[model samples]
Target: MILSIALKEWKLLIKEKGVFIWLLVMPALFIVLFGTVLGNLGGGTQTLTYIDNDRTAASESLMTALGEQGGFKLEAKQAGELDDQVDRIREGKLGFLLVVPQGFAEKMTAGGDSLAAVELYSDGASDSAAGIRSALQNVATDYREQRLDAALKQAGVGDEAREQALQSPLQIEEKPQNATEGNAVTQVVPGYTVMFVFFVMISMIRRFIGDKTNGMTARLRTTRMKPLHYLLGMWLAYLGVALVQCAVLLGFGHFAYDVALGDLAAIAVLVLMLALCGTGLGLALSMVVRSENQGMAFVQLITMGGAALGGLWFPLEYMPKSMQTISHFLPQYWGQLAFQDIMTRGDHLSGILPSLAVLAAFALAGVLVALLRFRGFMKSAQG
Candidate 1:
């Protein structure tokens, strides 16, 4: 009887084409969009436009240094264009401009306390200005080092001593670990999957509210379909929905983006647990909410707020410490953690037991709440 009811719900859902658009198509688009965008964040060159009033070897050398050190594309504007560049920055159309003073070459070669007045005309509102400033500082440091090297050479210092004097104390090394490289696609795929999984509640809310409003619930009481069976049947149907949703999303990530999904068994188990958790919450929501509008408000709070706080949209380390601590309480966090563990860290089922346990706890809690509310929910429907 429950199976029959679930099948009926599935058929109805299928006929409503919006369900597929919301559950499948939307998430796939989001995956493709964000994955392609955030994946190439560090790939492109940032352009630096400069006015070289000095028009000398030293000014050109500084420009070359900025390009090399900052990985910036060099754009030389005539000194007459300085005012125009400044106006563009003021108008928010440009980030910044570099202006080398007329005496720049002479001051730079003088090598005393008198420094070249190389002005970075910039808009305070610009995001790129900070990076450009840092690049300029690096160029300044290199010039200072060159001066120091020349002085040391004049003072009869050996190559080894000069090298020892010039070397910086800080060093950064890039070391990558794990079974698969972590990138935007991996983050975005499981993220949107977990986020939209909660959206199954919206459909449930619509269905339950429909039944109650249209007298289907009252009519069901006259038949052999018990109220508990009705709840279970609806829950079971959405469980299938969530499962298919997760599978399609993960499959898209795998085949389309080549996001490595390590430990297939572990991923499968996590997806099952995630489906249960999402659908269980949906069931509780279906029983608890009085109207579709109110249910939608709750769904927004759950999906959007949870996505932000649960680290679904980005890494937890990027969030505030308090937020990171709060994320542990959300099911989205556990779902995402389990997915990243399986995909990036090469974790198997045993490795993800904690996240699975947390997801299961949330699922159980939701079911228990729905069960407690089922009597009242049905009573209202019958009236």
Candidate 2:
């Protein structure tokens, strides 16, 4: 009997043209659009046009160090070409330009309070330009240390003493706790999937309201069907729909964008938990609203507000600390955490158990609220 009701709900959902378009089509479009547009926005190698005015071995060594750092593409030009290079940078034809001043090698070799300064001009807005600037800074630091070593040698200082002098007094070793290799596609796909899954609530709630207004619920009371069976059937149907929606989006992400589903079992568990969260919220919402307009208003508030605060549109790391703190109250935040743990961090199911537990708690709360309100809601409709 429960299967029969569940199948009916599924069939009705499938027959709705709008549901098919929103659930399946729109998510795929967003994944492609966002993945392609913002995929390469992060850090990478940059090209710098440089004029070595100090045509000395020291300047050569600096350039070699910059090249060895592997963060810049060096384009050597004549010293007289500085004006032309600046023009190219302004015109967006070039990213950055470096001028190694005359006597730079002499100043570096002298190794005193006087320091060799290389002039770097770049578009501050470009990420590539920023990378080049950082690389240049590191190269200059290394060159300064080398000069110190040369000075020590001239002063008859031992090799070990020179090395000890050059070594940093304070050192930091970075160890990543999570193995998540974040990519544009991986970040976006799961986020949108969670956003759209919650969106399914609108349709599901509307369906429940329709059954009430059209006397379907009252008619069912005359049959052998218990209210528990009816409610369970609806929950199962919506849960199934949500699962299918996730599967389609994830499958598309895997095949089209080559997104790795790190720990498939963990991903599956997260998807199921998210589906439960959506289903329970939808059912609870269906019982509360008195009209279609109110239900839609709630849907908009829940789906959009949840997605925005939950880091569905962008990473929480980019948000203000307060905003990130507020996000913890939203179920979508936990869902994204679980998804990111598996998709990005390559964490096993055990690693994401906390997020799963939170989502399950949310689901339980929503179900309990809906069950408590179910009787009153039906009575109000009948009256």
Candidate 3:
């Protein structure tokens, strides 16, 4: 019975080219788009106007670092246009403007510190400016350190002595604990995969709702079948589709984008677990919403909400401690973390036990909710 129902759902879903394209093809399209834009255009790099009032070697070096560091692209601007530049920034014509004060080289050469002021002129509500701020600060700090080191060397102090006496005491060495650890894009890939998968999968639920509303469910029920049996089959078929979609995405990341996807066996396990959980989630959501339109709205909202809370778009490191604490309640967070551990960290299967357990719990919870909802709807139909 379950097999028959599953086959029916599979055929029904296959007939809907729109839903199939949205589920399988659209995500791949977006992944290609993500790779094209983010890979070529540079990820997280900001464009700032470079108003070099002082064209000294130090300022030049700073500009070079900003450009070479691959964080911000430095654009030259006239000094008189500083305010207008700010207005342009506010008007969305630019990101921000940087100004190097006059006499910067003389002060540095004379052993006096000079401030290189950056005019971060953006209209109110630019919290997205956090990344830009961090990048610029890093650029500025590098300039100061390099200039100070050069000055100390010129003053006959050995590099070792200058470092011991003046340089920061902290020496932080960043080494990737695993293959994908040091690579920013690779580390975030899993989060993106999980986020978009959730979004696309949930969005596909409109097909199920459409079927239910068009008397398809009633027509099938006339064959003397149980609701749970039919639901189980549909769940299985969708789960299979979800698994294939995830596998294709992972493979593309590995072969095309050079994203280190960790151990194959571990990745398979993660995808399977997530597919199950997503299937149940999609099914339960489809049952709960009243109409196909309402289902689309609800799924869109939930998908975005889950991804936002789950560190999909950004790392949780920047979030408040309270928000971080709350994020654990989201299943997407755990799923991404699990993928990260497996793919980025190259952890053994045993290392991801906790996350695997959590994912299993999510799958169980979602399935229970879906089954309960199915039961309720079935009883109403029988009555």
Candidate 4:
């Protein structure tokens, strides 16, 4: 009986063109658009335009050193262009410019504790300005070390003394502790996948409401189909739909973006639990709303509001602390967190048990609610 009803609902959903648009097409577009934009944001070389007024080996060496250490492609602009570049910066057209003053080499050559100024003009709003600033400071520190070496030699100190004098007391090392490296694809693919899963509620709500208004719910009682059986059948049908939707979205991410999916067993289990949670909520909502419009409004609220608060669009840490705490109560947050932990950290099924348990609890709660309200929902069949 369950299989027969589920098959009927599935065929009806397949006939609706909007189901494909909502479930597959929309999410694919989001993944492509966001993935491309963020993937290329920091990919290419940034040009650092400069005017070397010193015109000597010291100035040339400074430019070479800056280019090598700063991760930038250096471009030489004539001194005549400095004023135009400054104006462009003020007008938000240019990002960075370096000016080695005429007396810079003279000061370095004289070398008795005199400071040489290297002017860096940057647009106040530019994000790359800090990187350039820090690089220039490092170059200045190198020159200062050169001066120290010379002074030590003049004072009859040995090379050993100079080496000891210049050695830094602190050294910092960066260690990556995750199995897979994180990138824009990791963020966007799983993010939108978890977010759009909730949207399956809209279709479920519409179908359940349509059945009630058309007298399909009450009429089913004339057959062997019990009310609870009908509810379970509808939930089972949409659970399959949500599972297929997740599989397609995740598969698209893997193929199109090369997103690494870890722990296949964990992923499969998570998808099943996610489908149950989504369809279970839909069943509960289907039995509660008096009208399709009212149901859609609630769905939009849950979908959009949960997307924002649940770290579907961005990292939860980006939100305020209070909001982050609140997101713990949302199923979307748990789903997204589990996806990230698996895809990025290589968490297995055992590691994701807490998330799985939470989703199960939500599914159980929703199913209980649906069972309690099914009779009232049947009573309001307008058709």
Which candidate has the top score in lDDT?
Answer: 1
Candidate 4: residue 380 Cα off by (Å): 0.6
lDDT of 4 by residue, 39-112 (tens): 88767667888999999999999999989884688989999999999998889888988999999988888755
Taking every candidate in turn, the Cα RMSD to the unseen true structure, in Å, is 1.8, 4.3, 5.1, 2.3
What are the runs in model 3 whose C-alpha is more than 4 Å off?
Answer: 33-170, 182-184, 199-208, 224-226
Ranking by TM-score: 1, 4, 2, 3
Residue-wise C-alpha lDDT for candidate 1, range 141-248, written one tens digit per residue = 887899999999999999999999999999999888887888888899999999999989899999999999999999998898878899989999999999999999
| Candidate 3 structure quality by residue, lDDT tens digits, 56-148 | 897787678667766665678878878888787678766566687787667656645455464565546555456566776887677677777
User: Which portions of model 1 show Cα errors greater than 4 Å?
Assistant: 40-43
Decide which is better by lDDT, 2 or 4. Answer: 4
Q: lDDT for each of the candidates?
A: 0.90, 0.86, 0.72, 0.88
* List of clashing residue pairs for candidate 1: none
TM-scores for every candidate against the unseen true structure: 0.94, 0.76, 0.73, 0.91
Shift of residue 365 alpha carbon in model 1, Å:
0.9
**Number of the top TM-score candidate:** 1
lDDT of 3: 0.72
Residue by residue across 105-166, what tens digits does model 2's lDDT show?
88876645877888888866675466667777787677667767887899999999988988
